[model samples]
Target: MRGLASASVADQLIDVVSRIAVRDLATLRRYFPALSPDEIADKLVVGTARATEAVGAGVGTAAALPTPPAMPAELAAGVLGAATVECKLIAELHVVYGLRAPGNVRQRAALYLAEWTEGRA
Candidate 1:
């Protein structure tokens, strides 16, 4: 039962993360008025890599809080934090490229989650 409950919570968390819109098309375009979609995606890729590395690194990262936790706790935090960052990157890339995955928010989220897991934009 405990394991089941943990799984349920993790699923819910993933759903929420996937559904959340990190940015919209208009916002991305407005933010990068001078850059093409490909250029914007390039910048995002670099930023995401830096953020992911910060999350995985042990110290000096605000993204992974509760410093000095046990190994398991740190590991979990790093995983979740990096996932959140990657999701944001994927969402933003979709917006920049003017590509919306067809379906409801949940379905789109699932697609994005799959892309993230597969390690591609």
Candidate 2:
């Protein structure tokens, strides 16, 4: 249901992700159990930041940046995982919690994801 039609929310999401990617290993692992501390801490550091910044910069681009070129398989997977979580929770909050509009849903979801990820970090 969610799409990239909303630039503001998408921008917020990028900011959240950038911060999360920089988190300590123990902290990232605690929140994202699917990612090992080493997995997240090692190669993910660069990939995640790049992805985050790409999305952020693309907010004003005519077209969104395609997924980064040749991401480490692991970082690619982590980004997908995080994005899936963001999409699903955002849908739930919109449908169940009565938030309306794709932009609002994304912004709230970004906030929630940031809080959850950062808290553990």
Candidate 3:
């Protein structure tokens, strides 16, 4: 029941992302059988770093606030954008391999997000 204002949001975000990384390693290998998982992971790591930077930049523009209650909408938007990029990467990989996911884009993203959250417990 923690609100967005909780400091744990950052920790939650990191935990979810780490879980996604571990899960996606196997997923990428499955979709791109010809490619090395390590290499793909390296590229993804680089992309994630860039996305993180973008989000940081977005958050930096907001006025200094004591809590997330004062956080700017742009910051939330930036985080959402980063999440979208991560999800889209997975979807696009399936498309590239001619593999049809079982559901629509939102459903597929939710499935991936669920995998990410599974590591929380």
Candidate 4:
């Protein structure tokens, strides 16, 4: 059923966001050393919940149609923006730590996400 399918998608999105947010706290604190642990935790919790809600709303909207539409532009834009921010932060951290990666922003981001998710699994 459409409702079931939508629910499944929402669950997956939430799970991914939750996992990433939990793991990202360390990185967040590392990048923002001035922030207290409580501050980082609060940001992770609120940001992940907000992202999950946005993605869930997008999925619900698509599921209501007689035929599913292409992925919404707003959802796509949000995803891209999030990924870019993550990549930029990571790259900056690498620089701060005197580390190096092999490629451009897109390539490095793709590799980082791949490795990050793989570790989660």
Please give the CA lDDT of all the candidate structures.
0.75, 0.46, 0.54, 0.50
**Highest lDDT against the true fold, candidate:** 1
Q: Candidate 3 residues 1-121, lDDT tens each?
A: 5665655655444444434422343566675577654566556657756876776676676635557766656566566556555644554444444554566544555565554345334
Measured against the true structure, the TM-scores of the candidates, in listed sequence, are: 0.73, 0.27, 0.47, 0.39
Q: Which lDDT tens digits does candidate 2 get at residues 53-108?
A: 66444442422335445344345344445564444333333333344334443454
Evaluation by TM-score, superior candidate among 3 and 4: 3
Q: Which lDDT tens digits does candidate 1 get at residues 1-121? A: 9999778756864777665767887787787788888999998899989988877774335434655556555656666777778888987888787787778777777777778878854
| 1-121: candidate 4 lDDT, tens digit per residue | 9999766644444334333322234556675688765565455546645765676676566656665355464455455445433434444444434464576544555555554345346
Name model 1 segments beyond 4 Å from true.
Answer: 1-13, 58-69
lDDT (C-alpha) at residue 16 in model 2 = 52
Badly placed stretches (over 4 Å) of model 3 are: 1-35, 63-72, 89-101, 119-121
TM-score of 1: 0.73
Kindly report which residue pairs in candidate 1 clash with one another: none
Measured over all alpha carbons after superposition, the RMSD of each candidate to the real structure, in angstroms, is 4.0, 13.6, 8.5, 10.2
lDDT of 1 at 36: 82
| Number of backbone clashes in candidate 1 | 0
Which regions of candidate 2 are displaced past 4 Å? 1-73, 99-106, 116-121
Clashes of each: 0, 0, 0, 0
Model 1, C-alpha of 121: deviation from truth (Å): 13
